[model samples]
Target chain A: MKRISCDSSSIIALSSNCLMWVLDKFETEFIIPFYVKKEIIDTPLKGKKYSFEAMKHGLLIGNTLKVKETDPILRDKIIKLSNTLLSHKGKPIEIIQYGEADAIALAIKEDVSTLLVDEKNTRLLIEDLEGLKKVIERRTGRDFEINKTSAQELNKLLKGLKIIRSTELIAVAIKRGFFDWPYPRADIVKNALTALKFSGCAISSKEINETVDILTQTH
Target chain B: MKFALDALNFFKKTDTKLLRNLSDKILIDGFIEKNNELINLSIVVHSLSKICEKDYYKKDGVYWKTFVDKIQANLEEVASDKAQVIILEKIIVELDNHFGRYKNNVLHRSKIRKGSTLYAWGVSLTLASQMVKIPEIELMKQIGRTKIVDEEAQIKTISERLKDAEEIL
Candidate 1:
């Protein structure tokens, strides 16, 4: 069976109406990390559709992926190193050693697992994982590989649902109260639609127009 | 990991001198580097756009109505008008917390000068009044008159004073 690991970012991006449609088309098994599961069900999810409901019915596979916490010592090391590096500027050392760190550590232990993470952090994270594999291969004569799916690709899956249009996803998100305004709604809409289109969902222009109307009225 | 508390310290009273000691290159570059997340960058850009929106909403005379509706929907409170008002107030506070720094921009500067409470009041009262079928002129007159000398009052005027705060669509 083909195994894929998913995180909170993937689920959040996939929740778009259009993107969710495309994701429904996939039959592959997707894994969820323990921390990511916690984030999805937490209080902040109070009224969201993806709230504990997304998992209660087994839409997302929450059991297959492993959980890994940061080693206290290693975490301390990153902090200490960052503190010194940042001391001159008198800036606070805000080294994030948990979220991605846990994901990376768990991925290493899973052995050749494909991770689904946001694109901005992917390059740096993959490089770190590759470096670890290199060190281990040199010492133990063994190697492992990893792959990924970006937020954009996961979004395109929404179009497959065919219930909404890619362009209307942002309006839906806002109307659904997924995001508050005082931010660029257009940009948000663009980002949401980009994700759906990239996810491989096909949508018609007419559908986009209808969605815009619904969103305008409701939002 | 950098906690909010750590960032808070950088703004201490004594840091007045320290701020000058630090170069713009060091501080600005460090901030961008640390917040390289797409969401973080998006937040900055989004906040900038809202000011312009607030302006649009103000002009159409539907600013308060839309703002209250959004808050009510978010909190899932359909029956309680008071609850809706309270939630709208909180939402305004939250928006300020996130984008308060940009209050001086051409778009939000007017809102800030008018104050957050006034802005909230304008939006809430105007929106509430409209839903209840109150005439626009009456709603404006009623909301326009207030002696609640507090930050909330200031916030109310912030949205009202906008050049075009009522262009929802």
Candidate 2:
């Protein structure tokens, strides 16, 4: 079974779409860092409505979703790497939260197949080199010349890691007969993906439409 | 420091009207006592920085840069004391760097702790409301942080709670 580590945003996105239960249908083992669990559980209890819903969904998943603690040394290393990777114009950017750092560290330490996240910024950092450069340019207002060493370092850290969003999970669930709605197959897939988008999956309309088409055709 | 504390107290109350009145008092008194506009600006900046944990500048860097530039230009013309001017310039640079760090971190999608993010946002909203002399509640609603609850839809009868409890039990 593939191992998947999830950040809080993806969990919240899944919860918002009422699709958190679909994780049980997969053979994949889901893990969340201790901090990510705290993010889902504690923050919401403080009156964040969205977080509260996510916590409820988390509880519904129960033991299927493993809450793991990243090795402290590995967690610190990943945090340092994340901060270094995000710096622009030779200045360190302190943006990665403890939960995100812990999630990434756990994935790396445990050799998880994928890290599930729904934040646009994080996705770009891991997947889009050009997009990362554009973000640097926007933030610093300077031409971001990608240095060779930095590129190599980032590639090394992120190599062999797959980053997925909640939309993809929903698509998979649709393919696996997890959703038993009476709607047309195409409509069901489209609506499910679209709901994930509106629920903060950071997926574009075009992507959702394309995914819907692909899922229907594949079926 | 007293000014900063007073500003924070007013911010916590979400009293934009009182903050505006206080700003007027600070400006007048600061100018009369110190003959320095930087002092007045510093009071406001100190309060804003303290409350927002300096997240306000990060959220809107260009606006803050422009604001600091305007103050710097004004200080050059009005203040004859070079030492005071230099000190104010350092403050401006520090504020600029503070916001710059935030902007970079966010762009990189580096995680910021949930609690800090919420606190920063809350403080930023309060400071913006006070700066604009608008009610914080109005700003909160405008920002989609607060919503008009439908009383009828939200009402849960005692029977419903009992039924839920019974089902759980």
Candidate 3:
């Protein structure tokens, strides 16, 4: 079976008003890293208990799926990738480390045709991994690779779903370094959210705006 | 951040109006059913207080103590059940003490820029879900928020209202 594995980065994008469209575009076995589950519990789904109901239906298939632990070899590969990215970027590769990398390694281990990843720089990092490089080169006859799409493509896909408002998509896009820079990107997302009317759901524009403002003003 | 506080204040003022615009039956029955509104309000206040107490900038620019007191006062004034208000106050205090122990030692303004909005939304919605019994912790284990993806199913269930609008208008 041609499997499809996802990093948490993709999962975050998919669950938040983007699921409907992404699923429409890509359908296959989705695997998440065990660390992804830990990270989810640490944040995002922090207080909401409904995640259980969502998980029951296989929103994320990790704990139930039999995944080989990070063998010493894979661990060394990840550590090297981390160090190389850290050396190059001067800051750590934030999202695509730890469990996320494990997910990519697993996908390659499974010989999956497609790996759904969302972070921008993951491709570059994966280029340095020997095992994955061999697979990518053999598969593409050029290089073994981590497949990816940009935040922009994800936003465009969301727009197509009409699940979230275009303005909101643009805002998220801008926030994720989508809009170029300087201007408050969340403003774009807010406008998009307002435009979508968000299914007439009783959304707290006030709270969202406030949080974004706080984020902008302080940071 | 400035905007978030202003927005919160705006929401507080308009909160009653929101409950007001609904039909009298809803206000009297639905909003009051099993003290759902009261529970929701208490949870919101509790979470706000928690945020205020925990935020790093909270001590520098924000008045955590004053803000929390105001929310407490508002709950008392608006609460239909006086006893619940007192009980909720104690719980909030207890929570404050408990959470305070794990306070972040180094919260730099610089790192704030790197925060994830999806993570923020997830945390907020998770708290809201937990209060309503939908629970984000369990949801976190799942790949997505399946049960409440519609959102309308849990928090803002209004299919009946939509049907009413279609029929009457």
Candidate 4:
């Protein structure tokens, strides 16, 4: 079976807006790293407010998503390289947690090419070196330098690893007739995409308008 | 030196609004300096500022002291530099004890709230989470609730990402 790997945050984004059900609509198997399972299902289950949302995700894990064990050695290397890839004030900026790193490692280990991730930093670190440099500068009001060795090593590992957010997933799902939009209003797809953004999918207004344009125009 | 004293003074005064400047300072300095201690201090001040400003009773003197007095005692014992991280960790325990019902990691909510405020200030999600040591997932959820991403430009076009999703499916 074909598979796509996703981290916990994407699931959190999907579950936040009632879009987790769309996972079942695809022929592809949605797999998560073991650590990703702990992040989405085990850890959040203990919190008061998030416990209920966590339980909902637990059901999706059991019924729809498959859990796969990742290579710990590979996962750690990714974490170490990624956290040290960018530098600030003569110190390496630590980015990408074990959960995000483990998710990427599982994809590499399993030969999965597409990763569904909603966190902006992980995507930026993987796809945009200069964009990330500007973010660091803008946020800190200071300049930062990058460690080229770590950057090359990280790029070698993440080469050809395609990243997409939950917003895009919903757009694709809607394009393919996700069951949720039945008896749809003209604005349903746009609304659904917008809802995912407001629910923390890290989508921009321009992207949302553009997505709405493509999806609605073709619909 | 000055930050620690201001934190102490912020606690001493009835006005929680003073936290805005202190928080702005830490947010900028914490990222530029790449300092964990400043980041920890940032989380504490930002969380207290939000909590006090939003909640009615927390703004009042006696009720405010209930929270501040405890942070103050811990502040008194430590050197100014170390006081920030210590007080942050202590507040997690204090809040858990105060609520008395939820399991641990409840303060994940509070920690991520402060983390999102950093995101609003134009820091990347990973940088903000890394600074405060919160998970990306937790911080992402807070970002959704706050909808701060609406302000920033999207790095990739939506149509381009749609193709990626379609290819995977």
User: Candidate 2, residues B1-169: lDDT per residue as tens digits?
Assistant: 3444455466556465665556545543342232244333434433333333445664676866565555444344334443343344345455556655533232111111211122121112222333333322223223322111110121223233223222211
* Model 4 misplaced stretches (Cα beyond 4 Å): A180-185, B10-18, B27-37, B47-74, B79-110, B118-138, B145-147
Per-residue error (Å), model 4, residue B100 = 12
Across A87-168, the per-residue lDDT of candidate 2 in tens digits comes to 4345544435466667878988898757887655455556665565564454334453555555577668778667777777
- Off-target runs (Cα >4 Å) in candidate 2 are A48-58, A86-89, A138-140, A145-150, B1-169
Question: Which is better, 1 or 3, measured by lDDT?
Answer: 3
lDDT of 4 by residue, B20-126 (tens): 66866776676556677777776666656655555553545664567667767665544345454665567645654654524434345556766887766545554
Q: Per-prediction TM-score, please? A: 0.34, 0.56, 0.33, 0.83
For model 2, the TM-score of its B chain against the native B chain is 0.27
* lDDT, candidate 1, A90-138, per-residue tens: 3332322343333433444444245554221221223232332233233
lDDT of model 4, residue B165: 89
What tens digits encode model 3's per-residue C-alpha lDDT throughout A1-219? 334455544444435443323232222344555555554444444435434434532443443233344344653464444433221113221223455456655655555534444332233233222332232233223321222332332223222111121222233334444345455555654554443333222234553464356335543
- Which whole-number lDDT from 0 to 100 does residue A28 have in model 3? 34
Better of 1 and 2 by lDDT: 2
In the range B91-159, model 1's lDDT, one tens digit per residue, is 544445444433334323322322222212221222222222222222222222332211111111212
